[model samples]
Target: MNYEFLRCDIENKVATVTISHSPGNKLNTQVYQEITQIMGELEANEHVNAIVITGEGEEAFVAGADINELADLDTVGMMDLTQITRTSYSKIENLNKPVIASINGEARGGGLELALSCDLRIASEYAQFAFPEINLGVIPGGGGTQRIQKVVGQGTAKELLYFGETIDAERAYQLQIVNKVVDQNELSSTAKEWARKLAQKAPVALRMMKLAVNTGANVDLESALTIEATSYDGSFATQDRKEGIAARLENRKPNFKGR
Candidate 1:
């Protein structure tokens, strides 16, 4: 389906969703709604193994929410928005397939938070990031508070959020906020390369791996271990597991059906 605020291209087992609203691609209410719908559609497609999210141009991934909308929002409006953003982002985070944020340009405020919700983030050398809510007399009301902390630790997350500062791609890499940094020209290529590799693996095992990391990171040691143990055993119970072993013995690559 065609979208007014986004561009979607599905090739092989990967779907690339590009936020395409303008020179800066600011995320508006319509954009947010459509993005959630597009992701929902992708999630239901068995042929889609991975998703890459990026912006349309090199200027900015998303400059943040449309300033006009944010200015007019009352307390009730804010609460409603919080629910929408939280639910949409959580759905993306909990999706069975992996999602990668291809940070091709500036990812400020909500944009950065959206990228943070993804399983992995890879940035172009020219990409920049910031949580500038403080600049507007507000703080990140999105999952930025919790998710950013997990990706970059409490200290850096606090400093960045408090200062409302922008960091270059290199600095983000040093902080481990992004998994990898590559040349601007190679950003999309690198993301697709990673997605392609992930698509070749057993889908069930990948889902379990994602579950182990996401759920295990939030609990006590005993609970985390319990989650990890279940994930390990769950992967072993898949039909693909037996195929993998048998294929190894037969000197062939296993064909996984996501069973």
Candidate 2:
């Protein structure tokens, strides 16, 4: 399907989705709808093993939500918009395939929330991050309040949220908000390299791993252990597991068909 606010390119089992909305690539209702649609398409496409999300230009990965749109939203309209945005971000977080956020530039408010939804984040040295919603007289209406604390701990999350300060890529990396930070020119290639490596792994195992971790993180220790055990058992039943073992013994690369 075609998208007015997104540019998608698939190659080598990695689908890179670029947010193309101009003037900071701000997220809007239309963008959220397209995101939900594209994610479903990618999930059903067997050839796509991994996904990458980025913005169209270097100036901003996604500056934030469209302020103009927000200005017109009433309480009910805001709630509706929040639900749409939350659903789209949740789809990214819960997708069976791995997703990497290639943060090329400023990722503020909803943009940071979008990045947080991804499985991993690789930011360019030029990239900046913040949750500046407080300045707008509202807190982050997206999943930021929950996901940020999970990644960076409660104290740091609160500090960032309360202060609404912008952080450089190095500072973000130090806070463990981003997995890696590379030179501006290397951002795209680095993200693609990570996605390609992930795509080469056993598909069933990858899915199980993601499921176990995402599910386990929010559960008790005992429940988390059970989830891991179940995921392990499920992976063991796959043909890809057998192929992996055999390839190791034969000293050859495993050819996983995602079975």
Q: Write the per-residue lDDT of candidate 2 for residues 117-154, one digit (tens) a residue.
A: 99999999999999999998999988999999999999
Q: Write the per-residue lDDT of candidate 1 for residues 1-259, one digit (tens) a residue.
A: 6689988888979999999887688876777788888999998899899999999888887778888887898999989888888877888898888999999899999899889889999999999999999988999877998998887889988999999999999999999889999999999999999998888799999999999999999999899999999999999999999999999999998888889
Q: Give the lDDT of residue 233 in candidate 2.
A: 99
Model 1 is weakest, by summed lDDT over 10 consecutive residues, at 22-31
Error of 2 at 236 (Å): 0.6
Shift of residue 225 alpha carbon in model 2, Å: 0.5
- C-alpha lDDT values of all predictions: 0.89, 0.97
Q: What is the overall TM-score of model 2 with all chains considered together?
A: 0.99
User: What is the total number of backbone clashes in candidate 2?
Assistant: 0
The all-Cα superposition gives candidate 1 an RMSD in Å to the true structure of 1.2
By summed lDDT, the worst window of 10 consecutive residues in model 2 runs over 134-143
**Model 1 misplaced stretches (Cα beyond 4 Å):** none
